[model samples]
Target: MTYCVGMLLDKGMAFMSDTRTNSGVDNISTFRKMFSWSVPGERFITMMTAGNLATTQALISQLEERTKAPSERKPSILEAPTMFQVANIIGTTLRDTIAARALTGPVAASPAPNFNASVIVGGQIAGMEPRLYLIYPEGNFIEASPETPFFQIGETKYGRPILVRGFESHMSFADITKLLMVSFDSTLKANLSVGLPLDLMLYRNDDFAPFHERRITADDPYFEKISDSWSEALRNAFHSLPDYELDA
Candidate 1:
């Protein structure tokens, strides 16, 4: 269980993912759910994964290895000509990993554990348009549109509405971060499955380089400030909105 979100803005893209993985009451651990690769000024890609740790880790490992291999199997994420191709590689990797794991387990149990993982992939490849996509377990995906400028995966229900009410295609990168803090707060308050230290990415349009990548912890000053201010603002907004009168 986790919470990961990617937002597509006119200026660029913003992403955040939690690092907590819990197996039971006595077993809680930290494993980064975010992965990024870039060719400096040319292209950049970031992925946030949720579900079974083993499957996600294996997929990421293969992607990383492919990037480093002398004779890479195909168009790896690092070498993809477009962001769409990158998504396809990741989707295929995830699906293949799931399929391989099935060979070792009982027929029915194989899919159960692996099918839970999903990925939110977003960014820009040089000479291509920036985009946000959600990759399902079946090696398929859907992209975010102008009308829908965001995609979220994992323990998603709690933090979703904040973006729904406030997200806009034209919002600046900073405002998008504030909105993400509010959304993560909503999920943090409601779901123990998703916990902090969060990895956040901010990419400016056509820059193809990200200088604002952060791992926000429980003690981080900026996150603390934003969380407090947002809670107070929400309470005030709720009270200030005109109440509907009920007719007799």
Candidate 2:
């Protein structure tokens, strides 16, 4: 399992993803679940994956290869004229890969192996509005809108409340980071499979570019501070809330 989120704010987009891949209690491993591509002044795209590690890696590698040989392959997401087309390309690739693997043998047919995968793709194309999408295992997807404004995959339930409570479409980069920390904290507390070392990407709208990107490791000082501060804040909030002292 993993945890990833993409928010479509009035300013632009913010994305965060965890590194942990669930194998088993004893077989857990760390693998980056986020990737991004930029075409300088032309376009910027990012994908945060969850589910089967092998399947996700294969899909990404194929996309990278296509991107590298643009003339020999269909236009990669970064080269697509619109974010919608970019998403279509990714979804097709994911579905085709799954089909191809299943043809190989019974081993591929088994769900125990790494074949279930999905991705969250978010970014911008020059002339169009910025967008966010959650691509599912079947290659179908849904977009984020003003009403939703955000999308999550993998161990999503635990972290959802925090996002709902604090997210604002007009939040600044700093405030968004604080909201993300709370969401990450909730997931970390409830799910063992979603662990540290996150990938973060922030794109300010109309730039046609990704101006900020970061890899957040376990020992990152700012994250450490935020975690500590949030803990204290939560404890105080809990104490201050009126309690149910029924028999009185």
Candidate 3:
């Protein structure tokens, strides 16, 4: 269980993913679920994954290895001429990795999640418009359109309402980031599996390099402030709403 989001904005794109994984109440761990690749002025790619940790890691590891040594898995994500092609390559790799894991069965003491992994992929390539996609466990994916400017994976229900109500195409990068912080914070409060230390990435249009990227820990001052303020605001909003009166 994890929470990850990718937003496509007028200026660029942004992504956030939590670093929490747990097997049971006693066994909990943190692992990064975000990966990025870029080639200066050529292209930039960022991905956040959720679902079976083993399946997700196997997919990411295979993608990373392909960049170092390309095999029949098609060109590395960095080599893809367009963001669409990059998504295809990633989806294929993910499907293949899960299939292989299924064939091998449970490994010793560790178990994989029977091909249940999904990813949010986004970035831009030189000459192409920025794009965002939600890749499903079956390898099929859908892109963000004007009607849908963002995609969220894993533990999504708790935070989706905020995005649905506040998202806008012309919002500044800062504004969108703040919105996402609120969303993530809300999800974190309601879900135990999705813990803190979130990874954030921002890419400005055509930069081919990230505008900003960082990990937000529980102790981070800004996140702390945002969390506190959002909670208070939500409470106030709830209290301010008009109450219904019953007529006898």
Tens-digit lDDT string for candidate 3 (165-215):
988979988888899899999999999999999999989999999999999
lDDT of 1: 0.87
Candidate 3: 10-residue stretch with minimal lDDT: 106-115
> Which residue window of length 10 is worst by lDDT in model 1?
107-116
Q: How much lDDT does candidate 3 score?
A: 0.90
Candidate 1: misplaced stretches above 4 Å?
Answer: 108-115, 244-248
Regions of model 3 farther than 4 Å from truth: 70-73, 106-113
Candidate 2 lDDT by residue in tens digits, 32-147: 88898888777888899987787899999999999888786577776778888989999998988877776664764545444778989998877778899999888888999999
Best by lDDT: 3
Q: What is the C-alpha lDDT of each candidate?
A: 0.87, 0.86, 0.90
Q: Which residue pairs of candidate 2 clash? A: 1-22
* TM-score of candidate 3 relative to the true fold: 0.93
Please state the error at residue 9 of candidate 3 in Å.
Answer: 0.3
